[model samples]
Target: MSQEMGVGLLRRHRDFRLLWCGETAGKFGASVTAVAMPLIAVSTLHASTLEVGVLSASAWLPWLVIGLPVGAWVDRMRRRPVMLAAAAVSFLLFLVIPVAARTGHLNVGLLVVIALLTGTAAVFFQTAYSAYLPSILAPEDQPEGNAKLHGSASAAQIAGLGSAGLIGQVAGAVNAMFANAATFLFSLLCLASIRDREPRRERTTAHSKALLSEVGEGLRLVAGDPWLRTLTLFGAASNLALMGYQSIQVVFLVHTVDLAPGAVGGLIAAASTGGVVGALTTRRIAGRIGTARAMLLFELGLAIFALLIPATSAGAGLLLFATGGFCVSAGVVAGNVIKASFQQRYCPPELLGRLTASAAFLNYGTIPLGALLGGWLGTVFDLRTAMWITTAGVPVAALILVFSPIGRSRDLPTAPRPRNDPGYVHPHSEPSPRSH
Candidate 1:
C-alpha cells in the first residue's frame, strides 16, 4: 500500500473510491426498490397482505436456489466482470416494471417474477463483491475501508428510502421504479471507470476440482470452524426473525397503524439513521471494548428493544416504532462491520469466496421462509398479532450468540487454529493443496 492510500483513502485511493461510489449507488437503488416494490403491490395492484409478503419472499428465494454454485463459480473467475454482468441484468429487469405497468401488463405475478430475477442478480453481485474487497486494500486498511463503505451504504439507503414515498406519490408509484433503474446505470459507469486490475489467478490443480466438491469444502469450512459456525448460525437465526417482521412492515403501518404511504417512508428512513451511526462508530467501539464484547452489545443487548415495534400506532405511538427500528438497525450494522473484518483476516484468502457463499447460503436461505411465515401469520390471525410474534423473536434469536463460544471470549480470534490442534477440525482427511 502506498502512503497516499494510508489515512486519507477516499481522497487518494482512486480505485477504492470508484468501488465505494458504485457500491453506495447500488445500495441506494436497492433501498428504493425495497419501499417501491411493496408500495406498488399494495397501492397499484391492490395486493393482499399475504401477496405483499410473497413479493418480498420472491426477492430472496434465489439465495436458496443458486447461492452455493454461484460462490464456487465466483472463485473460478475474476469478480469484477460478474458484478458488472449482474448489475446490467438488474438494471434491465427493474426497467421492465415501468414499461410493463404502462402497457397494462403489470400484475402480482409479473412483480414476483421481476423480484426473483433481480434477486438472482443480487446473489451474484453480493457474493462477488464480498470476495473482491480484500483484494483492493491492504489488511491494515480493511477496517477503515469497510467502515467507510458500510457508512456510505447506510447513508445512501437513508437518502433512497427518504425519497421513495415522495417519488411514488408525485410520479405514480409504478413510475418511481425509474429512479431505481437509473442508479444501476450510475453504478455501472463508476465501475467501468476504475483503472486498477487484479492479477489473473493461476489455474492450479485445486481449481480443477468438481463444483460440488468445492461447494462441500466451503460448507465444511463453516461447519468445522467453531467461530465461523457460531457467527453463521446466529446470522441465519437473526435474519429469520428480522425478515419475518420486515416482510410485513408496510402493510402493518398502513392498515393497523393507519398511517399514510408517505409516513411509512419517513419512519423507516428515520430509523435507518441508526445504521449510519453504527457503521461510523463500530471500529472505535471495537477498539475500546474488544470485538467480542462489542458483538454481544450490538446483537443481544440492543436488540431487546424490538418489542417496541409492535406498540406503534398512528400519532404519538409512532416514536415507539422508530426507536425500536433504530436500535435494531444500529445493532445489525455494527455487528456486520465486526463480522466482515473478522472474516477477512481469519479466513484463508484462497477460500474466501467459498466461505462467503457457504455462509450466506445458510444466512440468507431463511429469508424466504421468514417472509412466508410473517405473511401466513398475518393472514391466519391479524397483522398486529403477527408483528408481536416476530418482533419478540428478534431478541430471542440472539440467545444463540450468548450460549456459543463467542460469549466466553473477550476478543474474537485473529486467525484460525492449526489443523493438528484438537480445537481445529479439518474439512477433509487430508488438507487440499490449495489450503496450504
Candidate 2:
C-alpha cells in the first residue's frame, strides 16, 4: 500500500469515503430504529413483554432463514448493486411504518412485517458490504479503513440514539420512525454517488452445482477452521446474551427503573460513546497487547461488568448502567474491529461473502432466540430477574474464547494454516480477489 493510502485512506480514497459515508448514515438510521421501535411498542401500542421480544426477533429472523443463500448470491453478483437494492428496499419498508401510524393502521403485526422486510435488506446489504470493502482499498490500508468506518459508525450511533429520544419526546415516536426512513435515503444517495465500481466476477463452475453445495463450501470453511469456528461460536453466545438484555431494556428502564423516554435514549447514547472510544483505540491496544490477548481483555474482561445494567435505578444508580454499558459496548466494538480486520485478511477473498454469511448466520441467528428468552424471562419471573439471567450470561459466554486457540496465541494467525498442521486446518486453497 502507498503511504498516502495507508495513513489517510478516508481522505485519499474517494470511493472508500463514499462507502464510509453511506455505511455511517445507514448505521445512524439503524441506531435510531433500535431505540424508536421498542419505544413505539411500549409507549404507543402498549405491547406486552413477549410481544416486544417477538418484534425484536422478527428483524433478525431473516438472517437465520436467508443468510446462507444470500451469501452465495452475493458471491455471484456485484456487491454494490446488491447494497443499493437493499438500501432502497429498507427505505420503502421504513416509510411504510410512519404512513401506517398516520392512517391509524399501525399495529404490532404491521410492525413485525416491516421489521422482517427491513431486516432482510440488512442481511443483504451487510453481507455484500463486508465483501466489498477489500475491493476498494489495498490490504495494508484495510485496518485503518475499518477503524475509520467503525469509529464513525459508533459516533453516528451515539447521535442517532440521542436524537431518537429527543425526537420521540418532541414529535412522538412515530415521527422518529420517519427520521429513520430519511437516513436510508441519505445512505442511498451517498452510495449511488460512489465512482469506484466493482469489476464483474465470472461465475465459477462450482456455482453450477446445487446452491446447497455452494452454501456448504462456505459453512465448511468456517466449521472446519479452529479460528473461524471459535470466533463464530463465541459470537453466537455473546450475541445471545447481549440481545437478551437489550431486547427488553426499554421495558426494563421504563416500567422497572422509572426513567422517561428521553432519559432512556440519553443513557443509551452515553453508553454508546464507549464504542467510539473503542474503535479509536483498538489498533493501538492490539499493537500493545497482542490481538488475541486484546480480544480477551476487551471481550472477556469488560463483559463481567454487564451485570451492573440490571442493578440500575434512579439517580446515582443510573450511573451503574452507563458504566456497565460503556464497558460492554467498548468491548464488543473493539472485538468487532479485531474480528472484521482478521476476517478480511485471513480468509480467501473469493469466499468472503459466504464466509461472512455463514458466520453471521450462526452469530446473528441466536439473536431471535435471545430476544425471546429475555422477553419470556421478563414475563415469567420479572424484568430484573430476566436482566440478571441475561447480563450474567455475557461473561460466561467469554469462557469460550478462554478455551479456544485464541487463548494461547499472542495475536491471531494472519493466514489459514495448512492441513496436517497440528490442531489447525485450511479446507480450501486460498484464492485471489475476484475481478468484480
The lDDT leader among the candidates is 2
User: Per-residue lDDT of 14-67 in model 2, one digit per residue for the tens?
Assistant: 899888989999999999999999999999999999999999999999999999
- Residue 346 lDDT in candidate 2: 84
Check candidate 1 and list the clashing pairs: none
State the number of backbone clashes in model 2: 1
Give residue 39's error in model 2 in angstroms.
Answer: 0.7
- Please provide, for model 1 over 1-436, each residue's C-alpha lDDT reduced to its tens digit, 9 standing for 90 to 100: 3334435888878889999999999999999998989999998999998999999999999999999998899988888888899999999999999999989999999999999999999999999999999999888888888888888899998888877877876776777789899999889888888887777777884477999999998898889888889999999999999999999998999889987777788898888888998997888787776687789999999999999999998789999999999999999999999999888987877788899999999999999989999999999989999999998989988898889777766667766446334356333322123321
Q: Which regions of candidate 1 deviate over 4 angstroms?
A: 1-7, 416-422, 425-436
Compared with the true structure, all predictions reach lDDT values of: 0.87, 0.89
Could you tell me the C-alpha RMSD of candidate 2 in Å? 4.9
List ranges where model 2 is wrong by over 4 Å.
1-7, 204-206, 416-436
